[model samples]
Target: MQNILFRLGFLACFCSSAFSGVTYPPITIDLQNKPPGHQITEFRTLTILIDTRIDVININAGVGFFLIQVHSYMGNITLSDDSDAQISGTNIGLIWKGNSENVAHFYLFRDHLALLDNITMLIAVSTYSKYDPVPGGCNLSFETEIAPYQKISESDDFITVISQPPSQFGNFCNRSNIVTRMYYLYLSEHDNSTEQYFANIQKMISVDDIVKYGTLVLEGLTANRFKQMYSRYAGTGRVFAAVSTRLGRSAAYVPAVSYGCDVAAWDADCSGPGKDIFSFISGLAFALLWLFLWRKFGIPVVAVQLAFLLNGLLVASILFYSQLGDIYIFANDATFWTCFVCLLIVTQKPFGCLTSLFYIIALSLVGSYAVIFAVNYYVGGNLPYILLNTYRRITVANFGSAVIAPPYQTMDICQTGLWVLIFCIGVYVQTRSSMGRPPFPPRRADRARARVDENTPLIEPNQEMPPAYFEAVYS
Candidate 1:
């Protein structure tokens, strides 16, 4: 009994340390006033942003490995200043997580920080036992790696290794509700001078790009304050951050400069007030038609969808032949068409109720597409081009042949706002309009009543039959 009690007490102590065991070197004592960094000791996760002034953040984890991710979504992890030193020590790993813009530095290794504005993510994990670099990318479901494990003795313990390759390459990520831009940098260690690191990074992200996108400065208090924040509010912000981020960014991670629909087209063809006006008009027409006529005239809307789908399929085939956007884009659109066709087929018999659901989905798509096209066309946002270049790939999908989609500072708020607004309204209006309505047309109630009356006798059961009734019966 005493031994068991001792074991329980030791386990409690170990657990406490594991939950709050990150210790920073004494050199960071002066930064006692800034905002605290984000940390979750349960996963041995710690994230702190360093800028021009500060240097030398050496985080030591207790009981297990530390996972440090310098991601774009949580704000950038910038090492702009030349004087900045190494942020982490050995046995710790860094996951240089982000989209295509931020992940380019995956090969740069550690002990070398650079002026990072955009590097597409490459996930690397350096465990105390060994280092694993996942060239495929970061998995958002990676928190499971830190789950409690059963020990099979100190020398040979059991651990779970999970890797979920993202589906965004073919536009599958958005459908599964995954954010491709989020990088979870597992800690790593290597030897590269800061100058060489910056130079290599400059090759991909030049000074001009930095000047163009501007810089992100994340302020945090001393490493001690980070500890305090972790103890006080570690897990609470993650959920809110995720929710707010998804709502803010159209539920997808759009890269800074993606392949535009008219990627090789002339500048004038891609953007103009005239084109914007036309796009706006067409988009508005489609949106209104979906709102008002989809329930009443679903067949016409479906016909339009079929036309677009066929065009998209043809464009995808051509793109495959030309090698324009890559096979993933082709595959993505093909999947969409296949799924839609299957939905239509099944709605005929076994699941006729699916027709109503199908209409709702179709309406929502129309509304969202219309809004996204108009807004992105006007602003030259990357999303519209991504839609055409990646998911739709339809012939004549150009926003404008002469226009180039410029990198925007942030997602056009108006676009996302209007997209969401229009989608919600479409869903609400269509759903309400469909209430108490049958999924398919039925015989008129009055007609049914009339038919019943014609089949019945014209006389009461208990009374003497009328002469007319008898004559009718004889006839």
Candidate 2:
């Protein structure tokens, strides 16, 4: 009887070892290059491999889980952080199944992080067993250490790295606040790369800090300039208030409530070029030049149009080249070239009603946009959506390296007043100047009359003989 019992015990041990090997393969998570703590800033794919026996679906708030609220903004569904709130992605279905494997993968649908700014996602790993959550048959048995394995292919859409929650976070299946690790990722707007090092999460910003520095507003602060100054503070987990207003009006600042990158990281001052002073001067110069000399500088006006269109094409080409391997829908080079050829044909012809009409419309728009762009630096303003998008894309494409500006949002009475004033003035001046002008350049008779006025002799040197002279000789 004793010998038989010993053989049964050995057989049981051998079976247990074989089952463990089959269930949990080697999965090592190299946390060396990643940001300090649990943050993952610059990864395309973050896969969390949890044991199949862990019960993640029925997590309870009493077990350190926080309530999440959903809201709608402008007809789009959104998540809100209410008082005593926390957020998660998988709960709301943001993380979909990338493969049949039991791994958690988060795929960010929005390309622009600003759209999802100020949002934090919590990932909870419960210790409850899937088979029995009633405090019985709890299988807290898994490998403690995992070895490194092969990396996912770069050619694949998602570069995958398997990871598991740190072992230090002890069992929280039945208790509250056993251990919870907060992580953050500060990503660049353009390439989703790490902007800077992650800082300790400052859950609260002092009232004094908000008043003394956060609410301080700068004069002539442009969206671009504001971002340029504040982006350095990104990932530092600082809080501040941002104010956009007209004519330095005292807009109430909303205090920062959460910790995220660039929530409102505005500086009191910037050393770069002053926004209003330079843009106002340059924009005013262009508007005034166009307004006063629209008729005199017709060819130059056409040239400017050419330059503008060509610049747009250049930007498009650069964007296409930069995103060569990525998939995106943008205007092709052939289409842009075709449009360029068409514009050249239209603008390069001799002055006519069509050309004159184009001159008035194009110059008026240019003047209007320039004035608005400059004035918005001092007083926040709104521009037409299409024009604004064009301006933003061009500006960012050119100067994204130096600074990244947020999209414009403010719209007030001052912006409308200035835009109307400048646009009307441009149209009025161009119209009054162009009145009574011939649709086409002067005909031969008109040229002859002008030449006679200039005291040219009737029988001139080597000129084509007039019909009158030929008729006399033939008769």
Candidate 3:
């Protein structure tokens, strides 16, 4: 009994730690303050952004492995100083953990401590575990490494564009949806520091041409308290955009910079999200359609789903041929396409219903594609991950001109087409079965054994019937 009690107590503690284990290090977080009049403590930090190839290197470890797991949903990160943290010792190495909502961030790996403004929140830990790189104490020790970021040629005085006009890349830039994508490509490819923060630009190359250009794209999100920022800065006349590289450079690609004013920047091409994606309201309609004219409408309803398949296909094709945004529109459109697509898919029925139940899986794709899918090693969650969503660009079919552009997103387009075809065919079979089969059939339980002699013909109901016809006359 005592042992069991001890075990239960230990288990409870373990569970608690798992739920709120190591103190997660946040970017630009405010350290705890002392009593009311106490002077605020300050820390020194420098940042240099650099990207090194992910060739496996042996890391020395003294504290079992101090992994730093920093998480953020808003893709915005700010660094006040020079570069990423440097890890001088050969023994100590960095490991990172990405949140279900965000993989684009890292406190685990070495990156520049670039929080233009630090957040004011301090989280302390209750226990000493191997996972904390950041033991918060009076004397905190930090590691450092020195590596140079990918550099652009001095002559390449390029511009950063957040969004172009309708002339955007389909997968990366969409005037209709995305304000901007975090990176031109995946997180790994961002080693080259060619990208700038809050940049939108004309496509010197297609969205998929990151490899060919060998450039890094820094056009990420602004998780900054935009509402507060505008109220304090833009609202109070802090012309950050005009002053900083965030906007207003008329060279290579950066055009007229704009803020996220819903009214001013209304996406004219904003055809609303797909109808099936908005299928929740359709539930009542579908029920009524079923109750009143189930047969008539069922087939018709399926036919109407053509809009879904087509829209999904349009989004998918845009994603598939993402680098070829010139064919689709003016600015890069990938990010907006993903954002809008996810919003619609997650909102609608069937798909929306699945979103609630699917848990981590739901996070794997759909809504947070750019953030969550940035590191997708191609396994793509429960379903294949997509440059274009699987429902549409279903496969990783190779596309693009051989010399200039890389293949759009990766997947089996042929397989996806085959599956969609099979699904439709299966639906057809089921519909036919529903229409042909009877809802219920009769059961034969009420038959009594009646025997007539072979020699005697059956009598009419009106004729008198007797149990013993031969003896009837005498009886």
Off by over 4 Å in 2: 1-61, 66-353, 380-408, 411-413, 439-475
Could you report the Cα RMSD, in angstroms, for every candidate shown? 23.3, 20.6, 24.0
What is candidate 3's lDDT per residue for 39-117, written digit by digit as tens?
1111212222211112211222222211221111112221111124423211122232122321222222232243343
Better of 1 and 2 by TM-score: 2
Clashes of 2: 0
Instruction: State the C-alpha lDDT per candidate.
Output: 0.30, 0.30, 0.25
Error of 1 at 304 (Å): 9.7
After superposition, which runs of candidate 3 have C-alpha atoms over 4 Å from their true positions? 1-183, 187-279, 283-291, 294-325, 328-421, 424-475
Provide the lowest-lDDT 10-residue window in model 1.
235-244
Off by over 4 Å in 1: 1-352, 390-409, 412-414, 438-475
Model 1, global lDDT: 0.30
TM-score of each: 0.27, 0.31, 0.23
- Candidate achieving the largest TM-score: 2
Q: Which RMSD does model 2 reach against the true structure?
A: 20.6
Candidate 2 lDDT trough over 10 residues, lowest sum: 147-156
